[model samples]
Target: MFENFDDILNVDDVAKALKIGTSQAYKLVRSGKIQAFKEGRAWKISKLALINYIMNQQ
Candidate 1:
């Protein structure tokens, strides 16, 4: 997980930053593993959420 990022990031950015596939990122968001909200057909993940996810991973 990355700490430096824009306030909000898209699935594409999350996928690249987390080194995971786009679908995997989506799955995380859909499964409530990563905090995110859907906008139309896209998912927006927050930097704080990503940080929380990383912290909780251990």
Candidate 2:
């Protein structure tokens, strides 16, 4: 699991965690596939949410 990630993550963090590009990270968030929310102008994804997504994929 994501032991090094924080409770909340940004696009770059998500990209690093998923081993994907930042653009793809943004697309995942925007497409509602990653379960993110916007805070002001930035998107925020919870570590638990990402875990859930990965679990569902399996």
Candidate 3:
């Protein structure tokens, strides 16, 4: 699931990739911990941004 995803991922997708809850994923996006932008009522996160975030954590 993590290996294949669209360029922009929804909060649910982020949660699955990180093995976290949707609520926590939303928090990460809301607080700018995970690079994302609001599109209408949805959050879209970049694949590169997610990768960067994971790398930075290490």
Candidate 4:
């Protein structure tokens, strides 16, 4: 199973994992529905944060 917050993922990764569209993934980040950071010119999401968000959604 996946583990740890150090596992940084990109927008596509988040989309695939969550079965969402890339635009929706970006929307989540932009709307604060998810946590992420911009590294250089790319947006990165923490696996732990995604999991936490999913859990809290219930």
Say which candidate scores most in lDDT: 2
lDDT (C-alpha, whole model) for all candidates? 0.87, 0.94, 0.91, 0.84
Instruction: Report how far residue 12 has shifted in candidate 3, in Å.
Output: 0.3
Please, what are the lDDT tens digits per residue for candidate 4 over residues 1-55?
Answer: 3552248888888888888999999999878889888999899898887888899
lDDT by residue (1-58, candidate 3, tens digit) is 2568888899999999999999999999999989999899999999999998998999
Q: Worst 10-residue stretch by lDDT in candidate 4?
A: 1-10
- Output the lDDT of residue 49, model 3: 90
Alpha-carbon lDDT of model 1: 0.87
TM-scores, each model vs. reference? 0.85, 0.94, 0.92, 0.86
Candidate 4 TM-score versus the reference? 0.86
Candidate 1 wrongly placed segments (more than 4 Å) = 1-4
Please list the residue runs of candidate 4 whose C-alpha ends up more than 4 Å from where it truly belongs after superposition.
1-6
Compared with the true structure, what per-residue lDDT tens digits does model 2 show for residues 1-58? 8998899999999999989999999999999999999999999999998999888888
Native-referenced Cα lDDT, model 2? 0.94
* lDDT value for model 3: 0.91
Candidate 3, residue 11: the lDDT equals 95
Off by over 4 Å in 2: none
Name the weakest run of 10 consecutive residues (lDDT summed) in model 2: 49-58
